[model samples]
Target: MDTSAIEALPWCADLSLNSANIWTVQQGRCAIGVVLLVEKSASVALIRKARVEGYEFSDRLALPGGLVRGVCGPSFAPCFEQSIRARAEEEAGLTAEQLSELAIAAPEFAPVSRYTVKCVERFAAVFTVRANIKRPQKLISADKSIQEAFFSPLPPKWEELAPANRLILARAMRDHAGDNVKTAARASVNEALAFCNDAAATVNVPPVPDPWMSPEA
Candidate 1:
């Protein structure tokens, strides 16, 4: 992950949906990916289980996000934000009202993919929210978009998160820190990179399959 890129996240420009501006490449091309940094009771929310097939990240633990398409069903907020919020709702079953209460931070970009991964220009944005949202139950009777939705404290256990999500999680925490957001951000960034390095140094082995999946509708 590029620390410089994380530090210089560009504020999402306000674009009107009425305009025919092409945010994504084309109708069936690469889709922009958006993620959220939702904090509840001093713990950050994390989701596991990717449904895509053959992708390196497929079926692995990851952040709550997906491809952004358009306005999330007639909301007054910017379409970009709505797309992210809708991804959260679709994947984690969060509500629009809950998303509205979130304080979104500047968005960060990354190369990402969807189920089939036809495009590689997917941009990932992180929204930071300091509120009281409960972790969804992890049973089949609960939310569908993820296998499990749980909260983890800061300095998160690096081994538990997917490679990509761990970096963004650190970036979001740093961006949302107190008056010393910069210092906090630097520390978190270092920790994230160090973990990445350590993981790379370790012995390679196939990851165990996780049972979490999108629940039946």
Candidate 2:
């Protein structure tokens, strides 16, 4: 599969809900896309001091993505596998296709955790991509929430990323060093599937029915 195709997998984002000021365990699944675009002339595609309203990490440098919904929703509707690429195109103004024909360069997976008012869990996935794109441009912040986006060389303080995301990026870097896309993809798919399976198992809430009434009453 192409790099974009691989990145477009239906990765789920976890959200948390609460009741009575106590954190209740509830999960809300939302599809998200993350892009890894590398250009020879660019140092990195990392944006600094970006802003997204209602979120505290406004100035943090991170990958560009947004919540995916039906086309009628705020963001464009993306197919199951193309969601990542679609969001990349929409948010960062970048277009990506499968790089199968090109030499399999580098591939990696990163785990990102979600701890909002909706859910709490360590979400894991491999972040893989080809490293030979021509003249990749700075990501355009189509959404007003983002203040800026650009490329930069991987930072020395890479370990500072959210623990889950850091893990995936570290793995991707190692796989890239070894030029092991196949292995990385396999491992990522397994992990992603396991997460989905576990999440599905928790959604077993049965419907509540009205109280029964006795004819004697």
Candidate 3:
């Protein structure tokens, strides 16, 4: 189907689609994971998307993210930063306008938040961005792939979360507890990436690039 986002990824050099409609990433792929937190909450009330039924990890609580494909431009545009920016908007309704810092969704911007996830066929580089939102429940979406979005309290019951989410979130809350939103978000995400190592292992991490690369691109 749409291959623009996959093409923009330098690492997906060996990407193909010979097996019907399924993509083949020989080297690996990039899965964009966003850690959406709300501002001034009593506790770590993290926002999680409830995946829609009939797909992998359906009905499970998870960070809003997906593969790099179809993110930058569902029709034509593509790029690294746009992919992340697009995912943040599409999944969490947090637009680049809302958080100007989110506009810089580039590689190497925060290497600490980057890591790899293993799969049977290949692996995925998990690219993450952490930000705080205002009243997450108000931003919940129903038209997207997810059934809905809601605030899942921090220290969420590990059993209720997606495996990768469990690993990442648990490690984040445990090792990076603090008050500063950005600092805490950074610590938790970076630390979790370092500790869990392969949170998306065995799970199909979707490629979530922006529908459009950018106004300039």
Candidate 4:
């Protein structure tokens, strides 16, 4: 991963990952989330999501994250950092300070814009933790948002994860290849490659033209 590239990114405050910033047809929206990768020994942590009443995909497995609301003055890097840290603590009982001790992956974004769908841009950061120095039991018990949480091998149990999480996890792992957690970095390469291959066959397409304002249109 290019640590320099991450460090040099131009922070944009307008970008967000808050669901509350729902975009209307006349405008676009931006939001952010984080993938909390907690590692110990050779295993990584995963939360078996609890079923939120009347919530869509509430039971789907996902990393610890939430909406990125509010601005962080001139730079949004602090917002991004704080958002993930807060979410990790809220949803998984992991502290931002603890996460800072681990390997952090470069931020990644996936923008989706289809005429038939909502136009929104979502950004995510990966906060990896090598918890050998921390008390795993205390951290685990403090997480109140999950139904069940457990540690699994690196590269994860692909079949056991939600489809979206599989890709997110793989991508974060790939970008964090140089993190302190060498096992996750090394194991994630193959998984990320495989996902990319499958994705290329389906999602690789030419850029969509702006139908509303185009010389050709």
Candidate with best TM-score: 4
| Candidate 3: segments with Cα more than 4 A from true spot | 1-26, 29-54, 70-78, 100-123, 134-137, 176-217
- Provide the overall lDDT of each model, using Cα atoms, as 2-decimal numbers: 0.45, 0.38, 0.43, 0.45
Clash pairs, candidate 1, are none
User: For model 4, how does the per-residue alpha-carbon lDDT over 1-217 read when each residue is reduced to its tens digit?
Assistant: 1223333434322333343542111112222334566667656667766766644335666666554444454344565456556666766667645554543443323211111113332322222322223655444524555776666767576555543355555554543444454444344434443443343223331121211122344
Give me the displacement of residue 203 in model 1, in angstroms: 31
Q: Candidate 4: minimum summed lDDT over ten consecutive residues — where?
A: 205-214
Residue-by-residue lDDT tens digits, candidate 3, 1-217: 2334435665445554333222334333433333433333534333344454344455666666554454333322243455555655676566666653332233221111232224223334444444555333445453356665555555454545554454444444543445453343554344344433443333333332221123355
Each model's number of backbone clashes? Answer: 0, 21, 10, 5
| Ranking 1 against 3 by lDDT, winner | 1
Q: Is candidate 3 or candidate 4 better by TM-score?
A: 4
Model 1, global lDDT? 0.45
Give the C-alpha miss distance for residue 207 in model 3, angstroms: 21
Model 1 TM-score relative to the real fold: 0.52
Best by lDDT: 1
Error of 3 at 214 (Å): 39
- 3 or 4, greater by lDDT: 4
